[model samples]
Target: MLDDYGLIRVAEREAAYRYAVVAPQCPADLMWPDIRQSTLSILDAVIKKHAIDKGRVFLTGFSMGGNGVWDLAAKTNGIFAAAAPIAGWYNKDEAVHLTSIPIWAFHCEEDDVVPITETESMVQALTDHKGSPRFTRYQGFGHQHSVMYETYSNPALYTWFERNRIDS
Candidate 1:
């Protein structure tokens, strides 16, 4: 998975979605942090380089990358319009500080790698603070299924993302 080979397949599909998949020349263990920093850097560069609407910027990920989405979005505060963390996990305490932005979480009930409890606990913490987040759990799906693929394939997900804009 550390190899960027699979991303080529995603790029080939295109599917009307624009993505900037970054691959840092680092060890596998460092990829997560690299992705986090690079994503922010890319967004900063894009905002400065083009006529960015600002309100339309979004962050999303799957599995380990899903955890990255939560971490990055939470850290950025008002920078991202919305976040969709698929089968991700994060510290519940950190989640409280993320009430400013909307989050849509996806998880598979049969997920064994991260456990569905992780997402449920995070969602509970977020909702307990009156945070508005949408969560959908695939009944029989397992951890291996690609949540991002499922998310992108569903038109409703794109529509939902398009509806929300960052309110600063």
Candidate 2:
């Protein structure tokens, strides 16, 4: 499930880690649901076939796919250990259900497509429920620029994923 501008490929294979990228087909209104379903199916297969640490499974996405990350995390419940949704939106009603996972969300203060308020509202909803989610806002960047450059340039995002694991 690759979203517009999303490229999912095998990034690395090593003794201790495997990295797979998932990019969703965008124009979000038309493709999001399909992307979600396919992604969930793939996740199920990955869980069955691989010796996934389960505790370390991470989901990260930008733009429309970022929205997918939020949706998947909320819908799948305990399946993902952590999530990073960059410049995305999640319904406040649905977002309240995300109780157990750690989320590190990113957004640009200047974003116009998906307003920063959406992220703020989500954080507020999560906090209202006593959930902990780390949020970062890039001051001058817009929505697209914030996610694209930040994700590629910073190695810390990957490290963040590696640091957490699902609680069994």
Candidate 3:
């Protein structure tokens, strides 16, 4: 779910952490399986190649990639150390599965393509299920506001990822 940024944002964090960026060729509705497969394959490869801390495996994405983060994080348990989905959406059915995972979601108030309510609803569903997830909402931003630019521009997001880990 690389969306359109290619390797721009993900590459910036490479100096601090090992990560794999996935570029999805499929359309949005049919992207789930490919995203899941690519992510799992990357995880397997990273574990085998690097003598790294398994608990520190983090996930983040922009736009459609962000949506994939929410979907995958909900589908799998204890696979990611933490998740940060920028302008991502999810269905209520995926709420319960995300209870144990630490999530930090971001969205803009004026995004016309995907309404801010998408992220809000997911957060609200998780909250109703007694799951607390950190959510950041921008006041005056649209679809092109926060995903790649702000998330990368701010160090706090990276620090948030570093602070969280899956309960192993």
Candidate 4:
């Protein structure tokens, strides 16, 4: 699925490793904790098995996965160096937890599956909390796979990742 989704290409171009965790199928009310644990476990497994630069770890995802990026980075404390949540949304109250993390959010103005306002509200919440998050809003694209393709393919995202990290 990662190859089909072009994550392999993203990893190769960034010279970074990307791990995708598959969560057990469940309803939304019961999903967040499991997803959070799965993400942390993957991080632990990768750090244990590879030469990972602990400080440069970043999180990104599209659609539902993008929602996961937002939730995980906000709740997981210092684990992620930065987060890029594409076409995703989260509780605006949780924005307080994200104030310290670097975020680069993306959404399409004509998104059909997930409304662009979801991302707009998040970015706004972050801003209200005095967080400086970069946002990329595209035109003529609905909330489809092409958005992720364009986002992951852009070299600027990787360069931005390089510029942000958890200060040890």
Q: lDDT of each structure? A: 0.74, 0.74, 0.76, 0.81
How many clashes in candidate 4? 0
Candidates ranked, most accurate by TM-score first: 4, 3, 1, 2
The pairs that clash in candidate 1 are none
Stretch of 10 with least lDDT, candidate 4: 17-26
Mark the regions of model 4 whose C-alpha exceeds 4 Å error after superposition: 12-30
Regarding TM-score, does 1 or 3 come out ahead?
Answer: 3
In candidate 3, what are the lDDT values of residues 1-168, reduced to their tens digit? Answer: 344353455465457644554344436457765668776776678776875567877777777878888888888877788888888787877889988888888888888888889999999999999998999988776888455587766778778877887555
The collision pairs in model 2 are 2-23, 2-24, 2-25, 3-23, 3-24, 3-25, 4-26, 55-165, 55-166
lDDT of 3 at 86: 87
Q: Give lDDT tens digits, candidate 1, residues 9-112.
A: 45556656554544323345775556667767867887777767788887777777777777887777778888888888998888778788889898888887
Off by over 4 Å in 3: 1-7, 13-29
TM-score of each: 0.80, 0.80, 0.83, 0.87
RMSD of each: 3.3, 3.5, 3.1, 3.0
Number of the candidate with higher lDDT, 2 or 4 = 4
TM-score of 3: 0.83
Error of 1 at 117 (Å): 1.0
Q: Summarize candidate 2's per-residue lDDT along 1-168 as a digit string, tens digits.
A: 223243232143222335655343546356566566777777777766876666777888777777888888888877788898888898978767786888988888899799999889998899889899999888877876545566644667777888888778
